[model samples]
Target chain A: MWKTVVRRLIIMIPQIILLSMLVFTVAHFMPGDPFTGIIDPNVDAARLEELRRAAGYYDPLHVQYFRWVGNALQGDFGRSFAQKVPVTTLIGARAMNSIRLGIVSTVFTYAIALPFGMLSGRYNNSWFDRFVMIYNYVSYAIPTFVLALLFIYIFGYQLQWFPTRGSASPVIPKGTAPYYWDMFYRLLLPGFTAGILGTATTTQTLRNEVIDAKTQDYVRTARSKGVPENVIYNKHIFRNAFLPIASSIGFIFSGLLNGSVFIERIFAFNGMGDLFITSITSRDYSVVITLVLFYGVISIIGSLVSDIVLSLVDPRIRIE
Target chain B: MATDNTLIEVNNLNVGFRFGDEYYNAVEDVSISLAKNEILAIVGESGCGKSTLATAIIGLHDPHNTRIEGEILYNGLDLTKLNEKLYNRLRGNDISMIFQDPLGSLNPVMTIYKQIEESLIYHTKLNDKERYDRVLELLNQVGIPKPERVMKQYPHELSGGMRQRVVIAIALANKPPVIIADEPTTALDVTIQAQILDLMKDIQEETESGIILITHDLGVVAETADRVAVMYAGQIVEEAPVDVLFTDPKHPYTRSLLNSIPNELHEDGEELHVIQGTVPSLQNLPRKGDRFRDRIPWIPDEAFDEDPILHEIAPGHKVRGNSWKYFHFEGEEME
Candidate 1:
């Protein structure tokens, strides 16, 4: 299994390189340069050309790529053109917030999905099952941003149950119990909104998996062995049912990260998603490329993580 | 038919499955019994409800979707009337089952030791060491080599034959009096099938457990069974001691089934006897009269009783309906 993990990591080297090239090329070809917002409008066209040349902006694409790659190898993503700080520094401060939000949302997703799916599957075609089915359909149909906004309106503004925007109260001092409590309280709405949006697929997948596992020949064997219904479900059914769901954990992680962009925008949360939008609009090429590359690497690692998880749970899946 | 040595008796057992709002009987009013130290083979083609009867005996059917009627009497208790909790105590302790597909029957993720130990855990008070020893013993009893090595491995690591043996070991864990093997060797190759059948016989001899061996293979029945019950549709159409059933198959369905088997006695150019038509689905089965009539159209309608029931033609020999008495091939005249 360690061998498999090492082999996968080795193979990811070329993949990451290719992904970096793609991200850089896409960012470079976009309409405006990073200097557009930074330089004065009254500056002469020759002066602007000198600035561009001085920055090596006139260099060939391959040269720029290699230069970027060389710097990237040394943990130097260059400075964000707009922020005037290292691209890594700009991202590091916000990445944690995004990760926290993603983690909270993931927790909510599984909390709502697992029991609901298991029960719905256990007592299939019952009223509770029907209710879950309806919930799945409605949740699947609604757009993530719309759901987030609706949640903010209902749970935040209208009911005054939770804070509508930002990750924490500005008044709360850092490193205090109250501050952590306030942070958790403020994280609820956006996390739940994003989390609820994700539940439909996980719930549906797990529901179908549970139903399929119940009918398997092993379940019958379990039953024939005089195992109690509860034990049969706990030992025989749930583990097998969770196999497919466990295998998709990496995809779920990547999805949550992608979803954070819209979720963070609506919540006005200071996360990677908020930074991403701001950087893109301001044409901070270095920051944008770094963030894109970070997301790309994360998604690649996510799949590998899920593979390891699946192999751990399912004895049949020998990674070697 | 409830003799002193009878292990289980099914009195007019009717197993039904629901389709939409309607309930259709899959096994209709079938009566049979298993005696101690005997192998009772229930032979039928697919869709004949042989499997349904087996599951019904073990009380394995989903209660919500299934409607099982009649009595499954075991040790003065009505198995049909037992709730899930009661059934749990009775199953694996008094009665156990071996399923058809060995690959699918054993839990893929569970180690062989855990699976074998499952029944022992539920039925016995054996501690960790005792359970561990019993697991290895069961594996060895089923003729599995390297019991110590195989115990730690999952179902996927074992071959098909090995897996079936593991399944048998699981069934034999508690030494249950009645073992319902539902086409136990059906999923195995011919050579493996023979080995599994032999293992079952050896286990039966040593344990003295009553075995209900359900299969479509007449060869398996002839080799291992003490008595044979021939099922057509959902009912037992013919039943007798194994030799009697094979040498003088009384039911038309039984005769047709026997004749269909390819043998060396057949001439080079002669065509094989094929039973016409397939077994009727539960929803389409004839609720009255001999259910096998449609497949043997050449047999005169007059020969079939309006409401056919098992009638004893000789001591320990029973056939359903009078049609078998008048049954003859289409090109042949009545003797």
Candidate 2:
């Protein structure tokens, strides 16, 4: 299994390189340069040209790409065009923020989905099952952004339960208990919104799987052994039903990143999603490309982790 | 057949499944008893409710979708009346079942050890060490080599025969008084099928447990069973000692089933007898009259009893309906 993970990591190197190249090329050919709107209108044309030339912006695409790649190899991703700070330094805190939200939201996703799905399936066609079905339909129909906005309006404005915008308060000192608590308190709305949005697929998948598992010959065998219904569910039905859902964790992880874009924006959370959008709009090429690469790497790792997890859960699957 | 040695007695049991709002009896008015150390084989084609009868005996049916009327008396206790908790106590402890598909019957993700231990965990007060030792003993008993190694391996790692043995091991874990094997060897190779049957017989003799062997294979019934019950649609049309059943099948369905098997005595180009029609679906099944009537249409409708019941032809042989007495094949004269 370790060998398989190592091999997967080796293969991912070239995939990440290709992705980086693609992001770079696309950003390079975008409509406007970094200086388009940010620079003063009265600046001398010659000075602007000289500045561009000095920054190697006029270099051939391959030359620029190779230089960037060469620099990136040494952990130097270049300075953000707008921030004038190294891309790594700028992304560090934001990436942590995104990951924190991602973890909490993922926890919420599974915690809500697993029980709901298992029970709904166990008591199939019951009121709870019908309610879950209704919930699934509603969650699926509403877009993540719309749901996030609605949550903000209701919980933030109407009820005044949670803070509406930003990840943390400026008043709270960093690394303190109250600061973390404040962060957590601020995280609930966005985290729950993202979590609820993510639950639809998993809940439906697990529910269907549980239903299928219930009719399986093995379940009957368990029942014949005089195993209690709850034990049969935990020992026989759950693991079998949960196998497919567990294998999908990688895809779900990648999906959460995609979902965070709308959630982070709506909540005004200073995370990778917000960073990504702002960098793209401002044409902060260095930060944008780096963030893209980060996302790509995360997705690759996500799949690997899911594969490892699947092999662990299902003895039938041997990674080697 | 004596009440003193009877392990289970199912009386006028009606096993039905719900379709839309109405209940359709899959196994209707079926009465049979299993004696200690006896192997009673229920023979029928697919969808004939032989498997349903096995499930009913084990109380494995889903109570929500299934309507089971009548008593499954195991040691004077009516299993049909037992709640889930009570049934749980009776199942795997006093009564256990082996299913048809070995691969499907054993949990794919679970190790053989865990699956074998599951029954022991529920039915026995044995601690971890004893259960572990018992699991190995069971594996050895089922003819699996290297019990230690095989116990750790998952179901998929084993062959079909091996998996079936593992399932048998699980069924034997509690040493229950009654073992219901529903077409247990149907999924195995012909060679393995015989071995499994032999193993089951050996286990039954050693444990002195009554076995209900449900199968469509006449040859399997002939080889393994002490008594045979031939089912048609949901009803048992004929039942007798195995030897008597094979030598003197009273029902048209039973005779037709026996005749269908190929033999060396048949001359070249002599076509095998094929039972005429398929068993009717549950919804379309004739709720009254002889259920096997449509399949053997050559027999006159006047010959059938309006409400067919098992009638003793001999001290030990019973045949359902009067139609069997007058039954004859097409293009043949009536005796």
Candidate 3:
């Protein structure tokens, strides 16, 4: 298992290098230059050359790439053009908040999708099953941004049950009961909208997988062996049904990382997505490239984790 | 654990399925009884309801979608009348089934030992140690080598024949009074098929449990079955002691089936006698005629009774309806 993880990590090295190279090439060719934002209109041509040369903008593409990659490896992502701060420092603070939400939303999505999906699939065509189908149809048809807006209007504006904007309220301090509770309370609307965004499609697919799993000959064998209906449903049928769902973990994990983009925007949360929007509009090349690479690394790691998880659940996969 | 001579008695049972507004009979009024240590093999062409009848006797059908009539008498109770809860108690403890497609018949994710342990866990009061030992013992009894290592393996790791052994081991783990083997050897190679039949025969003799072996192979029936019932198009056309039916078969379908068997005397390109017509689909089944009539159209009308019923013409032997006085196949009649 360790060997497999190590191998996957090793394979990810070239992928990251290739990806960074592509991004670097594109960033250089973009319509505007970073120096333009901070150009001294009064500076002599020689002074401008000094700034460009110091910034490594006058070097060959490969030289600039190696320098940036070397610094990135040491936890430096250059400086943001618009902010005039270390790109890492700018992203680090926002990245943490995004990750916390990512973890919560990931846990919430599966915790909600799995049990309900299996049950809804097992008792398909029943009233609850029909209700779940309708739920899937609604969640799928309406864009997630709209759902986020609806959630903000109903729960935040109308009901006054949750905070409509920001990561937390300012009244509570850190490490206190109200602070923790308030944080959770404040996250209710955005977190929920983000968590529920893609669950309908996932739940529906899981339901169909469960239904298909029940028809396998092994399930019938279990039934014939006098296994209780519930036991057969859970131990045999659900185990197989969960397989198809396991294959989707990488996508879910990736979604959790950036899946909150629209929700974060509507709720005014200053996370990666919020930073991403502002950075792109201001043409902050360093920050944009860092965010993209951050997302890419997380997704690759997610796929690796999913492979290990599936192999553990199914021995047939591990041996091969 | 009553040691009654009679084990399972399937009375005139009819199992039908509901499609839209119409109900289709898959297994027509069938009656058979199994005694201790008896092997009653149900033989037929594909879709002839052999498997369906066996499934019905085991209460595999749900009454919601399936319409069943008559009784499955076991231990003074009609199985058809028993609820799912009671059926659970009786199943695997008193009756178990060995399914077709052994590779697909055991849960792919579960270890072989766990699959066998299912019955022991449900039916026996033995602790984990005893259950574990019994599972290994079952694996040994089914002629699987190195049961200790095999216990840790999943279904896919084993060969088709080994998987079938695991299936048989599971079926026999509880020492159920009756076992239904539904085309158990159909998916196996010819040589492996012989080995499995031999193993079942030995197990049956040792336990003296009645087995209802469902298969389409007459060769298998001749080797292991004590008695045989020939089914065609949802009806049993003939049933008798294995030796008697093979010697003096009374139904035309049964006679045709016997004639189609190849032997060394046949030429390589010999046009094998083939039964011509397809079994009618359940939805289009004839309501008031011999189910096999369309397939044997050359036979005189006088030879067939308008409505065929199983009538005993000799001791312990019965033929359905009548086909003239004798059945002649392509001008060759076996008297």
The most accurate candidate by TM-score is 3
Q: Give the per-residue lDDT digits (tens) of candidate 1, residues B1-335.
A: 78899989999999999999999999998989889999999999998989999989999888889999999899778998888899999889899999999999999888889899999998999999999989988888999999999999999999999999999999999999999999998899999998998899989999999999999999999999999999888999999999999888878889888888888877888898998989887888889878888988988778989999897899889988888889997788987
Interface RMSD of 2: 0.6
Maximum-DockQ candidate? 2
Worst 10 residues of 2 chain B by lDDT: B292-301
Q: Report every candidate's CA lDDT.
A: 0.89, 0.89, 0.85
lDDT of 2 by residue, A139-174 (tens): 989998889889889999999999999999999899
What is the CAPRI rating of model 1's predicted complex? medium
Stretches of model 2 off by over 4 angstroms after superposition: A31-63
Q: Enumerate the candidates' DockQ scores in order.
A: 0.79, 0.84, 0.80
- Tell me the deviation in Å of residue B31 in model 2: 1.3
| Residue B112 alpha-carbon offset, candidate 1, angstroms | 2.3
Candidate 3, B1-335: lDDT as tens digits: 13478888877888898999877988888888888999999999999899889888788876778988888888668999988988888788889999999988999889998999998887889999999889988999999999999999999899999999999998998898899999999999999999999999999999999999999999999999999999988888899999998888879899889878986767899887899878888999897878887888777777878899998889889899978265688666545
Q: Which tens-of-lDDT digit does each residue in A106-150 have in candidate 1?
A: 889999999989999998899999999999999989998888878
**lDDT tens per residue, model 2, B232-329:** 88998899999999888889889889888987867889999998889999999999998888887878878999898998989889999888879888
Tell me each candidate's TM-score: 0.94, 0.94, 0.96
Cα deviation of B284, candidate 3, in Å:
1.8
